[model samples]
Target: MKDLFDYCEFGDLKLNSRIVRTGLWESEREKTGNLTPEIYNRYENIAASGVGLIITELYSLYPRDVFSKYSNTTNYARFVREARDLTDLVHVYDVPIFAQLGMVQYSKKTEQNIAIDDVSIEDIRKIQTDMIMAAQKFDYGGFDGIQIGLGNYYFLSRFINPNFNSRKDRYGGSTLNRLKIVLEIIKVIKETTNLHINCRLNAFDGTTNGMTLTETIEVAKILEKYGADSLQITRPRSPQFFTRENKEKNPLIEASEQIIKNVNIPVILGGGATTQNQINEILNTTDIDYISMQRPFVADPSFLVDWQLEGNGETKCKTCNNCYWKKTSTCFINRSAKWDVKSEIPKKS
Candidate 1:
C-alpha cells in the first residue's frame, strides 16, 4: 500500500516523503523585501520536518503587484546572497526547494492593472524576460526548481484562459495560441537554466467560458511536450473550495487523476487533504503519488514528524485561514509558544 511517508522519486529528484509543501503569503519578511531570520527559522523547521519538496512562498515578479505586499520579491539587492543561504539551509535536510514566481497584475508606468488582451507584444516580451531573469536568479541562488504560478487568478493564469483572453493577435483564440506565451517562456528557461519547471495550473476555473477539465488535460499534455518538468493541479479559489462544510468528493482528486493519465510528467494534487489516512487513501486509490499542503505547515512546520510517529496524525490547523487572510506566515490560532531555532533543531531519522 502507498503511504504518505514513503520515500519516492518525483521526476529526477528523490524525496523523503510524498508530501510536497506549497507556500502562499509571507508576512515575516523585512520591510525592505529581504528574508528575515524568522523566515529562515520557519523554513529550517519545515525542511527538517520530513517534506518531500518545498515550493517557497510567492516570489512576486514585480515589487508592486497586487500580492507583492504579502509576498517575497526578487527585486531586492540581497536576494541572491540571502536566497543562496536559504537554499543551502534546506539542502542540509536533503529537501529540494523551488522558488514560486508569480504576479497578480501587469502594470507599466502610469497604466495600472492592464487586462490580458490589452497587453501589447512589447509587454508580453517584457513579462517573459522578467520571468526568465527570475529563473536565472533562482538558478544562481542554488534553487533546485521554479514553480511558475499559472494557477489561481495570477496574470498569466488569466492570460491563458479563453474567458479572460480575447486578444486578436497570435497569442489568443486556440488553446495552443493562448499557451504560446508560457510555452515560449518554458523553452527559454530550459535553455538558460538547470531549474526544473513546475507549472501550478487550474484543473477547472468554474467559469462560464474559462478553463475546463478537458482543456486543462490538453494544457497539461502541451506543457509536457513543450518542456515543463511537472505540474500541480489547483482551482481558481483553492483550499476555500474544499471547506469543512462541503462533504462532497473533491473534484481535484478526479481532475488530478485524469491529468496524470494524459501527461508523462509528475502530477501533484494540490490542497484539500488534512490527515495521514486521508492522504494515504488518495495515494493508494489513485495514480497521484504526490500531495501538496500549505496551512497545516503554518500551524506547525514539524507536524509531519508527529504524523510519522503517530501513524494516524491529523493537523492542528483549524483551517481558519487567518494566516492566509492576514497575509502572515505564523498561525493566529496555534501560536502557543515561539519556536527556538537553536534549541529545536530537527535531527534526521
Candidate 2:
C-alpha cells in the first residue's frame, strides 16, 4: 500500500506526498486578469503548507472569443508577463504547478451556456488550435503542466456527455467520437511542448441521463492512451448540494479505483474527501495514486500543515459550500479577508 507521505512521480512531476491541492476558484485577479499579491499570498501559504501539487483554478484560454463565453468578471487572458510571476513564486517551494485550462469558461449558473449540438466542426477545429496555443503560453510561463478541464459540464464535458451532446457528425454519436477533440489536444501538446499534461475529468455526473462511471472508466483509458500524464477524478455537482448522506461516501472513489486499475497514469481521487483517516483509508485500500481536496484547503490553508504535525484526521473546513458564494474563495468559518476580490468589474458605458 502507498503511504501518504511517500514521494510520488507522475510523468515529470515529483511530489513530497500523495496530497494534491485541487483547483479552487479564486476570483482574486486584476481587471487585466493579472495575479494579485493576495493570490500570491494564498499560494505561498499553500506551498509552504506541504501539499504535493498545486492545480491553479481554471483559466480561460481565449478570454475575448465569442465562442469561449467567459464571465466578464472572471475572464482574463492568462499568462501575461505578470502571470509568469505566479509560476515562479510557486516553484520557489519546489512544488509542481498545473494550470487548469478551460476552453469554455462558464460558471455553474451564468454566461452564455452553449448547447453541445450547436457547436460546429469549424468551431471545434478553432478551439483545438486555441487550446494548444494556450498550453504553449503556459509552458513559456514556466508551469509544470496543463490540466485540461474535461469535467463539470464545461465545454469539453458537454461534448463528452451524450445527454448534452446531440450532433450527428464525426465529433459526436459514439464515445470515441466525443473523445476525439481531447485526444487531439493531448497528442498535439505532447508533440509541441515538454510540459506535463493532466486532465481534471468527470468520472460521473449524478443526473438521470448524464454520464456514468462505466463510460468514464473508458474515457480514462483513452486519455492515458493519448499521452495524458495524470487524471484527476471528480464528479459533477448534483442539482442539489450534497447532504450528510451523500457527502460522507463520495461515489467517485469507487469509480476512481476502477479507473486507476485500468490506467497506468496517476489518478487523483478527490471530492468530499475531508479527513486524514478517509484519505489514509483510500490510499491504503485502493490502487489510487493520490488524493486531492478543495474545500479543506480553502477553509484552512494550513490544514495539511496541521495534519502533518499533529497526525489528526479532522479538517477545519465544515464543507458548508459558502466559499463558492463569496466574491473570492473565503472560508465563512474563518471570516478572514485573505483575498482581494475586485469589487466592481468595469462596465462598457
* Local distance difference test scores for all models: 0.92, 0.73
lDDT of 1 by residue, 299-337 (tens): 998888777666799998888888877888889998874
Regions of candidate 2 where Cα sits further than 4 Å from its true position = 62-78, 104-112, 238-248, 337-349
Clashes of each: 0, 0
Best by lDDT: 1
Per-residue lDDT of 73-151 in model 2, one digit per residue for the tens?
2234554465578778878877888887775533222435557777667767788888888888888788888889898
> What TM value does model 2 have?
0.87
Q: Each candidate's root-mean-square deviation in Å?
A: 1.6, 7.5
TM-score of each: 0.97, 0.87
Q: Give the Cα error of residue 77 in candidate 2, in Å.
A: 8.1
